[model samples]
Target: MAPGVGGAITGAAAGKFFSWLLESERARPPRVFVSFDFDNDQQLKHLLIGQTKRQNLPFSVVDGSLKEAAPEPRWKEAALKEIRRCDVVVVLVGRYTYKAPGVLAEIAMARSEGKPVVQLIGSRSLGYTRVKGAGKVLAWTQDNLTKLFGND
Candidate 1:
């Protein structure tokens, strides 16, 4: 093959590959609502979100972090709005999760909105206390996440 023709073929192949990547990203699963105790589970939340992004996972977080400056009602409303937009909710159940009213309320909102709930136990020894409408209580693992939201 002529050198110019070979170069043209390679360029076209690269373009097609990148186009497919973009389309795959756009076709990923709906945003996920993450419910957790902001004070206690923030690190775990960040770790999970970071890992998903680092590995190019097929899910995006709905940013349920409440502004501490906002009033309680405002925070609740904001969280509910996010939950309504999400396809599924993942409750990060840390040791203090049961004591967090906001986390519990977020889970309730997800349930009321008919969003599927997955309770991710942050600590293996903590023992899972099933969230009201959670369909599964899974340990925090990339494989589990992939199982719930298949790789795109």
Candidate 2:
């Protein structure tokens, strides 16, 4: 092989290898599937999502869209699929969250999929109901959220 051609090929290979290594090293934020009371706390869910955009939190909320899934069976299936895709599940606890059937089902699905569940207190007011089997709720905060998702 010509000396110039050999050097050029080796340099190109090294550059490609370096790029690949960097790409693997750069870990994207965790994919979070947020489960919230759909009927009574849609606004709370929106607010949480808004924080993700504005604060640039260390997690991306996966749009499971289980609420729109047709029929009860399909909804469960969709929930399971979405939960499987996410690295963790974040349940937004509201005043009526404990009674929400959809939220309850989603939480169960998340558990079945073996995803880590992080419950956040959605309402600041007292007397908010916490969902059962969803673990204890933590006060929502940027640092808290960052740490939760950063655990990976």
Against the true structure, whose lDDT is highest?
2
Question: Each model's C-alpha lDDT?
Answer: 0.81, 0.82
Residue 120, model 1, lDDT? 90
In candidate 1, which residue ranges exceed 4 Å CA deviation?
A: 1-26, 125-128
**What does the lDDT read for residue 66 in candidate 2?**
50
Query: Clashing residue pairs, candidate 1?
Result: none
| The candidate that achieves the highest TM-score relative to the unseen native structure | 2
TM-score on alpha carbons, each prediction: 0.74, 0.77
> Model 1's lDDT to the true fold?
0.81
Q: How many clashing pairs per prediction, in order?
A: 0, 0
